[model samples]
Target: MLVLSLSTVAFLGLAQLADASGSPSTGHRRRTAGGGQAMNLVRSAPNSNEWSTQQWGHWAKTQKSSLEAKYGGAGASGTGVQKRATGTNYMTNQNGDSSYFGSLAIGTPPVSYNVILDTGSADLWLAGSDCTTGCSGVATFDPSSSSTFRNESSPFSITYGSGQAAGFLSQDVVQMAGFEVQNQIFAVCEQVSGGLLTAPVSGLLGLAFQTIASSRAPPFWETLVTEGAWDEPVMAFQLTRYLNVSGVQTLEPGGSFSMGFANSSLYTGDIDYVNLPVTGSYWVLPITSISVQNQSISPPSGQQAYAAIDTGTTLVGGPSSYIAQIFQQIPGSAPGTGDFESYYTYPCDTDVTVALSFGGRTWSISPADFRLARLTQRECLGAFFEIDSGGSSAPSWIVGDTFLKNVYSVFRYSPASVGFANLSAVALAQNGDASGAVPSATIGSSAARVSATGSMLPKAHRSAGIKIGCGLLYATSASLLITIAVAGVHSVLL
Candidate 1:
């Protein structure tokens, strides 16, 4: 399992500034250009977290579309225009057989091998068979055997807050739906370790739109948009844990990822969109504030930072100090005493309210979502905040399902502007809950639905780990060793 670490907090913090104040001239605006709302592309710095001076110029040179356009509306045999396919099938791997994969087709030959569909990551990756791996469960793609394979050895690596994976860059002919694209830039992990290999997927297919793609390549989703394969550059997802269990499923061919649009019924029409500031090459956003129970807390002043809004992360993470302050406000939240500083807990039954103040809006999380998991009695709740020894100074945060459950988020990026739309409660109700939990089916399949049931971790294991860690830490401390030993003895006697 990927040990979701605290280092991601800095990245999240940087992305929160998507709407920070900036000059209209310097930021992306929804303007009528080229007869339509042309998306203005912003490039991140060459080797830093800031946006670079080269904006549209760099994108124009590097951007590749996955679709081809036809003139007019082409019928089955007519010469009218038809749009090329831009999306691909995302899959899951179970045991060792591709047929047993979760969301993908059982018998379809993979157009692109070693593909990964990850909720905890924003970019897709594939490994060519030639790469290196000392670990197990790694799949390799034989590009030569596939008629749609293309290689572009750009050499890439993505370092998460918890660990790092390196691989070579290559392009291959990829097919999904009715679309076929040649030479797409994808990464291959040559050496991967630290439990990430255990995931049931071969590689990563990031669902987050292009805005947050790693610097090595253009986002796969954005590549399709730029090619005019899509009418708009927008994508939306309602992920339910159990429903997504198999992982090899694909969206219906004509279904909309719904780029640049919001389902108004899910939330209030009050949309908070921000212009990203160009700080070097990276597009950076500033987080103004964070809160718990609707009470706002001040962040480090004058430290203008940028972050990427990532859908791949499971929890909101940031710098230790910043995270510490945020968690401090929660009534029963506490730090872990283990080698991994990324674990936290709280009373299961506590009615907690956690909110993030960003882009002039307060995004709140309810008690049900804040509680990591329920105990055997289904009465106690566990806290979800994690601290990382690696993220002591970086100002980043990953806003995952914990907070997204209460809102309907839409991500859009075109030449005109890149922003998100929040929908109203009506839409949310129709889509079920935003929390990605599996619903109990007291009824039959027709009435089955996803429901919130707290965190993924089992309560018993959590409690045991906490007890053991606390016992060890307390027993080793000079001031508490004797006292803890005495308490242990006394407890045994009682």
Candidate 2:
């Protein structure tokens, strides 16, 4: 099926600055040597059946058309909004369906709010009391209820594939995992429309650099580093996936987020670090090659080859022409019918190996991760899809979680680099099984019930059982009940 995206326009202006400096802006602080915290990252949409390939196909088509119209030009030098992951994770219900979610706290007394930890956009926002559309059935934040709330009076607005949010800037105490940052900057959405109400999600927590942040404020992770919350200056993610005894695809609990430090225990071997361009937005990287089973495919050259490493997006998207080459290699794969022209279908059991090359290293994606879903018992959709790049101004690809899941990833703010390592047995658990020993839940206990639209914010604290050694507070939670409410597809499926 197709995919949707969150688009940003500011990254265009920042690319030039980065090209000259050989590095991104150095305003961010370096992590203390060997000091950092860890947090568990959960699937934003825990209920997977709430989404459909058909629905995703429709969303992808609409998003492509929107991009073409918005950025199409000859030799357009400005950075066009490629794909905004919108900072969402998905999970599934019974029968192998999926959605992903995470938890955070806001305001005084630390009211818990469920959020999608997105690496796409760089903003943190939640629905406020003033939101009229797509605000029902979900939790909302009331400024009056927060003791630390402060209004900046600056208006804010954001656009996504299926919806839009408009609100005002505000400041309050924000706590993620367990680390608390007082007077953190965020947005209060007063109005929302389109597909936001489809799922049970409170809001999105952007994990990208502050350059692309709408508030132009330091994102939560950056602030955490600046404050020396951890012993190291790195944030690591270990995403887990599994094939259950019933052959049902499921997300395991091994997924985690480590702040201020990269846990060597989670990954095997050395982390090959790569320079991520300071695009003033997403973690943009250069691509040297792409192939499937040793068959190389040529991606769009020049500006198009700069790919964005986004965890918010569910699919790997790029120009339709390039995607066609990859799809052609899959047996039984053919053009999708009706609404999903950009998508392709293949046999569910097809054995395929997709490899992506960057920074002189090739990372491979197995058939299990590349296969999006089983349309029937025999037909399946591929996770890699075509995204119109408006000729050439857009990015060559938006590397989503489909690729990120296979590796233990580290996103560093200062020097702006992205690193990847092979997921080890210690990091992903035995054979991708989550039934082993449970880590001690590190979430702190705090009680304050605010509005819950699609999912309730659990008042209990959780952790992943990682010790900071430096005696710093770790944000890794061992037990976090996350309910991801995706708007567009959820509305259609539910």
Candidate 3:
């Protein structure tokens, strides 16, 4: 079946950054741009071909398990914010399920490809001209077509939680918006397998540090920073949500991303900043505590843990025991009946306050965001799931899009840190419509723009924030194992 792998977290053992030949730009250059450069982020309509089957849910589960085994539970390690340069921001397009993509041009004349602007992993890869098998709808990058393409001697291979890609490393001119980075190093895949074949993307551009990159090359943003492309050294994300418009629930492409500086208009309150520790090649944040409805929920181990913020992850994953503890408080919450053994379904409109504290401040998620969908007349599935990373001591949470859509986030570099602010009133329209009722008019008067930005490869998971229909898509079948991972804090959707 065709699937949208989108952004899956695939964890590679942490390593030192590799040196690249004839680099795009040196890091010594100083940037001068002063204001935030904003890019339009569009959300694509869901694909029926993908959602109609149970494959996505099963794949997500598998990917999630993979992540626990790779970097969660016991093996998960600590994680980078490097000095950034003045860079041009590019527009992002949301694809099926967990995928948010953008366009970039490569080669001499510049051939554009629709790629995932993932902050989870730190490698850039696309189908090369030689990929004839399983590469049907993707845009392939050809070295022969560019005058500036430079071939590297090193062979490259990247493994996601559910798929794999292998090829040779090469360098060329990479372009975003109107900006260009000369001799940008990237991987050109001659072969791809598993869930990646079905993903609705041509390639992936990882935004993390070089430690986790498969090709070991500095990310495109790093190259931009080295070239002194920004007035500031930051990126921000204003992830949009599913809106009900004119009595129809629509997932519109309405989010924005900014580079170099923050867009004050996208947020309502002050930006709360926190230091980021690059423990294991990820933007890992220390969690002070977790509370449900203002009451603290203790984990099975009663130990404090950290959370890795990942854009590539679809769902918010927690330890199995902690997840059970959190959901136990909800009346009528019970085990799911299908391939989703790792998930639970609770009563519709259940009132519960879920919050995570990072850097001493707590950010609460709306109750409305918890409901995945109605299972029966009064039952609704939840967005949270129980995942066991064999080594319980590893970071216990993979905070994904479910929580991200509710806030405006900034990813700062040089001395890596993460910042959060309350989303503007306009961006909160989806949260305000708690009933999930489709409205008669369009929502939001102005475009919702924000910035701070920053990977993993796994079989991608579905976002819990999107509404699901109780149809043939979720029928119970034989037991299917679910798992996940990403390169740095690589996580899966459940």
Ten residues in sequence with the least summed lDDT for candidate 2? 10-19
Q: Please list the residue runs of candidate 2 whose C-alpha ends up more than 4 Å from where it truly belongs after superposition.
A: 1-37, 44-99, 197-200, 227-229, 242-254, 391-394, 430-494
What are the RMSD figures for all models against the true structure? 19.5, 13.2, 10.9
**Can you give the lDDT of residue 337 in candidate 3?**
49
Candidate lDDT values, in order = 0.31, 0.50, 0.49
Best by TM-score: 3
TM-score of 1: 0.55
- Winner on lDDT (1 vs 3): 3
Best of the two (1, 2) by TM-score: 2
Residue lDDT tens for model 3, 285-347: 777767886778763332336576765555577767778877887878887646667788787
Model 1: per-residue Cα lDDT over 1-494, one tens digit each: 01121111100000100111100111232222111211111110111112122321221111100000000001001111144322212111111111111111100123322222222223445444664652243445565665544444344554332223556555543333222233445555565433333212244454433323342244444455555444456544332221121331211111012322333433456656556443211222466676766666676343323343433323344455776666677676676433223444556556778766555566666665565333323233233443232322222443443454455545555432224445444434422122322110010010001111111122232211110000000000111111000000000000
Give the alpha carbon lDDT tens digit for every residue of 1-494 in model 2: 00123221100000001101011112221122233223434332222233356554544454333323212211101111221111111121111113233456677655655444556555577878777876665678899988878887666665443345677777777765435556667778777654443233466566766544545567766665554454455677766664222332322332566555676766888988888754445667887788886788885576667776755554577777778889888878987876667778888778778998776578998677787656677877777777665444435576766687788888876667888999887755533453532122223421111111111112132111111000000001111111112211011011
Ranking by TM-score: 3, 2, 1
TM-score of 3: 0.73
Ordered list by lDDT, greatest first: 2, 3, 1
